[model samples]
Target: MNNLFHSLLVFATFLGLLWKIHRAFRRASPIGDGCVCGGELCLSSP
Candidate 1:
């Protein structure tokens, strides 16, 4: 019983770590847009 509980805990931790990594990657910008900094060059961009 204890072994099963420990395994589940380890699995949960692994899943949590994977979720954080996934979120980090998903939040990154691939467009490299200068509008992120509120620049004048991108002011005209919709």
Candidate 2:
């Protein structure tokens, strides 16, 4: 019984760490000034 409880505690901690990493990646964007190879396009037209 004691060993079972210890294993469960370790598993929960690992799961929490994975959740944090997943959230961090989800919040990141893939596009930015450096990411674009083409020159900037004007958003307004005269």
Candidate 3:
């Protein structure tokens, strides 16, 4: 039971890290920037 709990904790931490990295990349991406500009052209240009 203890080992299973530990594994679950580690898996959750790993998923959190992945989520953070994904968010960071999404924030930096051109598509994200284009959305702020509010046009289909902006999205298509990038």
In terms of TM-score, the best-performing candidate is 3
TM-score, cand. 3: 0.65
State the lDDT at 45 in candidate 1. 40
Backbone clash tally for model 3?
Answer: 0
How far off is model 1, as Cα RMSD?
11.4
Model 2: per-residue Cα lDDT over 3-41, one tens digit each: 999999999999899767744544464554334323343
Residue 11, candidate 3: alpha-carbon lDDT: 100
Instruction: Write down the TM-score for model 1.
Output: 0.61
lDDT of 2: 0.57
TM-score of 2: 0.59
Q: Residues 1-46, candidate 1: write the lDDT tens digits.
A: 9999999999999989976774465457564335344556444544
Put the candidates in TM-score order, highest first: 3, 1, 2
lDDT of 3 by residue, 1-46 (tens): 9999999999999989976775576567756645555655345534
How many angstroms is residue 5 displaced in model 1 relative to the true structure, after the best TM-score fit? 0.1
Candidate 2 runs further than 4 Å off: 29-46
Query: What's the residue-level lDDT of 19 in candidate 3?
Result: 62
Every candidate's lDDT: 0.64, 0.57, 0.70
